[model samples]
Target: MGITIKDIAKAAGVSYSTVSKALNDSPLVKKETKQKILRVADEMGYQPNIAAKKLVSNESRTIGVVWPTVERVALTTLAAKINAALEQQKYHMLLSINPTKTAVDLFNRFQVDGVLVFGEEAHEEIISSSIPLLYYGEPGPATYPTIDVNRRKAIQLGVRHLVQLGHSRIAYIGDLNPQHSNQREKATGYTLGMEEAGYSHLHEAVDSRGLSWQAGYQAVKQLLSKKKPTALISASYDLTVGIIRGIKELHLTIPQDISLVSYDHIPEMEKLDVPVTAVGTPVQTIATEITNHLLQLASGKKVPPAILDVELFQRQSSRSPE
Candidate 1:
């Protein structure tokens, strides 16, 4: 049978109520006594029942993370980092892949201290909840803080990098869905960057069906045969992988024949046949930002919206067109 708090109290020679206070690290208990009680509880292998503890403290010490698209590599890494950060603070993280509304309802019922949703778009009928919610996208009137990354500036950095390499014609690869604000923002940045480079007519936009390598391959293939640009900028790490595949299939070499840049800091994206230049905030930076916001909300503090900017990285996949 598993050890119980009563057994721990008896072994430590403390009252059951005092054991409880010690386990909770209540200030009412003496530090030395609390340490001794905790050591005895640990030695007895007594695990505190979180459900019972929550009933008394009214804090679950759990944060809910809502991420519908588990396929995003960057987001997956970032989520893991954020979870680690929360764990360091003695808070547990709960992940939910349900739709926005369902996920919100689930967290609300679970009564997590706060919720972090990692996307810009929400469901058509998102239920309002009393739980403190923070979104990693555009700010909404949903009575919670929102954190956003400047995706448009990220793409513009990529385009500007290519332009400085003496590439006049450039193509952008991203989802053309107007509903996807993130993708649209990147495309907008590409257009603006092209105009700034005095090549407005040379700017090309290719729509990937989804943010995957397959989508990138097909989109780039179609564009390669129709209106090939001097350089290509992919909107996501997966899409960039696909673009590299498409380039190889077309018997083209990176930089020597075509320059390539992608919108992520994925290490795999840099280990390709021709290392890719990139333009986006590092995943660690984004993860740290998100963790800070979640911790703030957990402590009953107001958190304002955040939109982190992107930076460019030059690599072997790109060179001056001269």
Candidate 2:
């Protein structure tokens, strides 16, 4: 049998109740006593009975992350960051790739402290949930507290920056699918930014269809076929990479030939051949905000839905178009 709290209490010369409070890090236990008990517990190889603790506290101390589109590379990175943040708080993170409804039900049955849903799609179908629910993208019609990055503002920042660099002919490339609200927001921002700059006719310059690297390459190829824009705004990091590859294939140079700006803010963008200027919330910020909000919900605290702001990080890729 494994070493239990009672065994540790005996070894530390404390009551069983005192050992329990110390193990739980309760304030009722003196700091010195708690430290000694923990040390003794470690030396004795004492193991906690999680099942019993859950029964007593009525909490699993676990957060369920319901992400239907696990294949999305950006979401995968965000999830890893969130997992690390939760681990630091002594909370476990459980991931489910199941459909939204199914994942909600599963998490409800498992009685997790809270559920963080990853996308806006199919959120309308989730009419109700027994557990606290926090959404990570567009809130849609759900009543749950939602947290979303300002996708539209991110694109606008890129467009405004390019315009300020004296680039009248600017193009945005990304997935313009109406089904994806996030992409739609970015596309709308591109149009709005152009209109705001008194270049409303340039709204047609939004070349969008897919979110992949090939899509960005093909879109740039097609755009170049007609008339090469002075500057290009890619809707995503992967798309930016593909756009760069396409530019090289056409024997063109960035900034000198065609300035570039990307949508998502990621570390990899800075490490590219030419560090990319990007506009979006940093992954660490997004993860930290989401994790902190989820913890608040788990604690039965009220948290208003949040639309996190994005910022522009200028780097080597952008310059005045010659």
For all predicted structures, in order, the TM-scores are 0.89, 0.85
lDDT of 2 by residue, 22-51 (tens): 988999999999999999999987877655
- What's the true lDDT of residue 133 in model 2? 92
Model 2 stretches with alpha carbons more than 4 Å out? 1-22, 25-50, 120-124, 205-208
- Cα lDDT of candidate 2 equals 0.86
Q: Quick one: RMSD of model 1?
A: 2.7
Local error of candidate 1 at residue 320 (angstroms): 1.5
Q: lDDT, candidate 2, residue 258?
A: 93
Q: Provide C-alpha RMSD values for all models, in order.
A: 2.7, 3.1
| lDDT (Cα, 0-100) at 304 in candidate 2 | 95
